[model samples]
Target: MQHDEFIIQVSNRAPLSSRDHAELATRATLETLAEPLAGGEPFNASAQLPRGIAEYLRHQYAESGERFSLDEFFGRISQREGVELPDAVHHARVVIEVLSEAISSGEINDICSQLPSGLEPLFEASSQGQIRVNT
Candidate 1:
């Protein structure tokens, strides 16, 4: 995702930020995942996540030295069965999940390659779930 596309995907879901911060956040999260592709390991499990979707999360982690946090927004929504998330996070999760699936399928470069073309459609299709970005 030539960095810019990753930033765009994040801004599509969250508040926009300066380009530098966006890039830093993207690199941080990707770096967190770039090693030892053993999926079942703890770091691997946590690293598989996409934390760069929200500028706030990135800024928070950068300034406060905390990694991505689900507790702040969703508060463990994925843990409790039948509990629903707020529309925004839900939609963001959809986008992230799709990206994750593509990554897992060894299509990271393929998906990233079609970034400009594929991104909007992926975001739009993810909107079909019970979620809305409101922006």
Candidate 2:
């Protein structure tokens, strides 16, 4: 999807008040998601995302993943997005749902493969939809 469409989806789905809010949520979630993905995985995922938004994933990559739990993942997103934990989690779910829609199924499947099982809930079919990472 194009960047504007991606942000619009995130904004509408999260029911956020503004485009800026949606952008922040997307950035936070993508950056945090990048933290746990080892090697060039984040770069691989970013390859399919829109240009500027993809940097959120690209900037977070390391030679190896910095292991953390699902809760910790949410914690980081909460901090980054400057929202409360519950909002962060919900926004994250929405961003992930959009991400799945933006990228190919094969790409998303590769992403899911890298995450721990606990984080799997983010990808599970939801009433809202599926997993997303970046714009």
Candidate 3:
């Protein structure tokens, strides 16, 4: 699939629009860090990429009732991608920290805060759709 299409697939699966963006950003960052994770790489001993994310979020909601620690969130993702997750995890954490500080300092809601609205929704829709139908 093309990059845009891949992003769309990612969106559909995300539980919330914001979470989808974070997830996609993390994936893109990971892909850029090394090589894009090979398709169909076994994420862990059993789970695939989508499954890992779903499990992570499910645990998050079950435990904290809110997302915490981009490091933890994306760390699980990197593992699922079958890569050493720390580089991506650190990068993602930096981005989050910067964004959090910016939001505290200013009024940026979106992480990038410049992209078109509904873009994240599209991603969540596309990603979740693909996972349920294809995977």
Candidate 4:
């Protein structure tokens, strides 16, 4: 997907009319996701994304993943996104759902390899065809 399309998906999925909000959600989620990604997984995964949106995934991280729990991960995303934890969690799911569609399975799997099973709910729902109705 192109950058606009990717942002649109994030916007619509997040149900936010603000274009900047969409960009922020996308940016924050991706940037935070990069922290725990080690080796070349982040770069390889970025390769599959749109060039504009890809920058968020590239960051100088540790040789190994930055160890943290799923809650702490969302907390960082929450702070970076400037939203509440609940909103951050929701935005994360939206951004990741869009990301799954935007990239190849192998690339996503490689990204997933860096995450522990506990964080699976963030992205696996889309892959498993699990519909989440947050009402």
Candidate 5:
């Protein structure tokens, strides 16, 4: 998907009001995902993502090599967004679900393969359609 399509899909799946808001949320989520997959073959996993999403992941390629678990990932997002943990989790789920739609299934599968087992629930949740957004 293109940047505009990505933003629209994310906005539709999330509570955010505009494309700018979706862009911010999407970038934050992709950056957080990069933290775990950095400095390895997995680091290049984002290459198969949509152009816009890939850009977000690429921006974090040179990050300080921070690593985090799924829980910590949500915590960092919460802190950065200044929202409660639950809200952050919800936002991350929405972003991930939208990403699943925006990218090829093989890419999503490759990403999941690179992550720890603990993070499986996030992808499973998205696949189960647990967070559908009203059109």
Candidate 6:
């Protein structure tokens, strides 16, 4: 999907009001999701993401190259967003759902391939009937 369309979809799916809010949410979610990957994998996987969202993941990879577990991923997002864990998970699901529609199956598969087995469910949950990753 195009950048504008991606933002509109995110805004509609999320509780955000404007494109800027949608952009912020997208960036935050992408960064949180990418935080678990090592080396340049995050940037490579983010290549198929929306432009603004991809930049955020690339920036995180360049700046810190931090790695964490799936639990820590949601924890950090919850803390940063000042929401509870369930809320953070819901936000993640929404973003991943949008991403599943925006990017190609190959791209999604590539991203999931880099993630550990435990993390795959997080993305797959959003995909629902569309993408199913065997655990």
lDDT of each model, Cα atoms only?
A: 0.35, 0.82, 0.33, 0.80, 0.68, 0.68
Per-residue lDDT tens digits for candidate 1, residues 1-135, read 333565666555444355554443344333322221222232322344444433322332222222333333233323221234553344345344434542343344333332333132222223444322221
Off by over 4 Å in 1: 38-135
lDDT of 4 by residue, 1-135 (tens): 999999998999888769899999998889888887788787888888888788888855522477777888789889988999999988888888788888887787777788765665565543457533231
User: What's the C-alpha lDDT at position 62 in model 4?
Assistant: 24
Residue pairs with backbone atoms closer than 3 Å in model 1 (clashes): none
- Model 2 misplaced stretches (Cα beyond 4 Å): 60-63, 126-135
C-alpha TM-scores of all predictions: 0.31, 0.88, 0.25, 0.87, 0.76, 0.76
TM-score of candidate 4 relative to the true fold: 0.87
lDDT of 2 by residue, 2-62 (tens): 8999999999999999999999999999988887787688888888999877888888353
lDDT of 2: 0.82
User: In angstroms, how far off is 10's CA in candidate 5?
Assistant: 1.1
The pairs that clash in candidate 4 are none
The residue-by-residue lDDT of candidate 6 on 32-111, one tens digit each, is 76765665766776677667667767763442535566777777777766678876766666777788787777777767
Worst 10 residues of 5 by lDDT: 126-135
TM-score of 1: 0.31
Q: Which candidate tops lDDT?
A: 2
Angstrom error of the Cα, residue 78, model 5: value is 1.7
lDDT of 4 at 122: 61
Residue 14 displacement in candidate 2 (angstroms): 0.4
**Stronger candidate by TM-score (3 vs 5):** 5
Per-residue lDDT of 1-135 in model 3, one digit per residue for the tens?
233333444443232255456455545433332221122221221131244332332221232223334344455556654446754454344333322222221222222232233222211213432211110
For model 4 the local lDDT of residue 134 reads 31
